[model samples]
Target: MRKNKLQRQASTIDKKFLLLSLFLTVVGLVALADASAPLAQRNFGDKFFFLKQQIVWAGVGIVLLFIASKIHYRLWEKIATIIFFLSLFGMLMVFIPGIGTKLLGARRWLVLGPITIQPSEFLKLTLAIYLAKVSSKNKKLAAYFVPLILALSLIMLQPDLGTAIVVSTIGMAQLFVSGISLIYFASTLALGGVLGFILIITSEYRRDRLLTFFEQTRDPLDKSYHIRQILLALGSGGLFGVGLGQSRQKYLFLPETATDSIFAIIAEEIGFLGASILIIIIVIFVIRGFAIARASPDTFSRVLSCGIMSWIGAQTLLNIGSMVAIVPLTGIPLPFFSYGGSSLIALLIGCGILLNISKYGKE
Candidate 1:
């Protein structure tokens, strides 16, 4: 009887959710192929260099997504603490002299021979799982706040303010869904806001980013150059766009064209209308994710699903919001659209787990 029940659940995974994830991933590859051509050619003498690597990562991500989907969602609950610590340890490994790779002044990647990964990316998912597990068991405030603060401190030490923000957001979202007291939630938010402000004012680059956000005309050729170019690309694509593969900005005009700023390239080539369609699809995907959370069979799965959706939604908002000048520039990549293997793989695995949880959700 139990075997039959398990088989039924496995056969009933959320198809809409799975299909949307795959669709966004495919669209991301198409956009990356166009956006990275010039940069790849100039840097590596091969126009397809970045695209080829991303395609390989995508293939791996898809396989993991399926494997994760097959695994029992409750498995994470049992090993949550172990994996969380392991991921936290991975973040620490990034600070080890020869093992850590420092790029653009940030020590955020672990380099083992030819393989490079940003451990902070995996930390986001692991932290979520751990928090959900503990919270579901009715743990105390110290249980949640300690791990949350420890993880955030390490990520900030890497000086990755963008990822720290995302991780903190994920932690807070899970805490909120787990039914923490309103007073504590409010206090946590206030504390986070105060700490964020202090961190920004104390850091030269962060202070400059904040200042440039408020005063776009301050340093057109220096601090604000990236945002200026982004705005130019956005304006160039009035309504229908200049058409795909024809973005002027992608031709060395935009910084981080294939990674953090890929969305701008998509907007430049596909226009406002096409960008709207992409945004709509993302919105639908997130909505379905929440629907799965709503139908989740238990508190752990429900909270975990919520955390995953919030992670995707918050990251997307930060990336696109920066592109449109709605918020200060955060060097976070768009989910599924970014060109990094670590991020893509981590996200797919999260989605896969979510799909597994959906199988046990109320029909």
Candidate 2:
């Protein structure tokens, strides 16, 4: 009877984590409605265009979250290798002539019938699963390192430096948690940094971004325009904010107002105080996620939980960091808040998996 009761207790889903996920999703929708209004009106003749699409995706994502929570967490471990390969294949699909959609000199999305998706976004989650599985079974760094390099190579081919960074961070985080040698981890970190610097210098546009970051005052109207606008919005929000739904930057003045730079809009509307509160909530969510990982009953669940939280934490930092000009703009969307179907759906599914693992955690 004691064993049975303990098992039952361990099987209960993490309600706090689930509610926090839903709250972020709902808050994202609210921010999107306010941030994308002008852009939607200008492009589609409907103010709620992006919000409507996001609402549908949010609904789909929430349903997946619950379904994923109910499924056994070990199921992913059984098929991690297969799904990781599928994710790689999906990345390759973006290079196909008829299916791939190229915009602004980057081939990052695929259009299938009426639906479009960014394979790299899903690649992040799949890679994390595969890494977790490999780490749990093998202690050797190369066991997971080879696949990490392969996935990073494929993503870099898409020329998405931002996502490549996030993916690499995810892999490295997993490697660390898997108890790899500190010397090997440090060596890899140094190598990655050197390679990243080389990549930046070799690409003209990327180099320009680096230079722009250093010389923000050089060209206010040209290369620095985007960052300038972002800073302006932040400045406008001063303390309390300009009031929600009244952001002037949303009127086509800020680039990626609803996507990569939505945080600025949020800061502009709610001010520093409101933005800080949101940040605090996100921090709490991450802390709770790690707590679940710490309590996991097996190595697989523990590593998997850590991977998911790392992905969220790394991406959130990148997005908000760039918005405030603390880091160079990387074109990565803020989780939940950014307006993209692939990102939102994949994230929610990952959260669901985390919730499932939480249920199996030791009391």
Cα lDDT listed for each candidate:
0.93, 0.92
Candidate 2 residue-wise lDDT, 1-363, digit = tens: 989977896679889899999999999999999999999999999999999999999999999999999889899999999999999999999999999999878989999999999999999999999999999998877788898989888888878989998998999888888888899999989999999999999999899888988888868998999999999999999999999888999999999998999999999999999999999999999999999999988888888898899999999999999988888989999999999999999999999999989887788
Model 1: lDDT equals 0.93
Q: After superposition, how far is residue 334 of candidate 2 from its true place, in Å?
A: 0.3
Instruction: Residues 1-363, candidate 1: write the lDDT tens digits.
Output: 978887787689899999999999999999999999999999999999999999999999999999999999899999999999999999999999999989998999999998899999899899989988988996689988899999999999998999988988898899898988899899999999999999999999899999999999887998999999999999999899999899999999899999989999999888999999999999999999999988998889988999999999999999999999999998999999989999999999999999999888776
Clashes of each: 0, 0
The TM-scores, one per candidate, come to: 0.98, 0.98
Could you tell me which residue pairs clash in candidate 2?
Answer: none
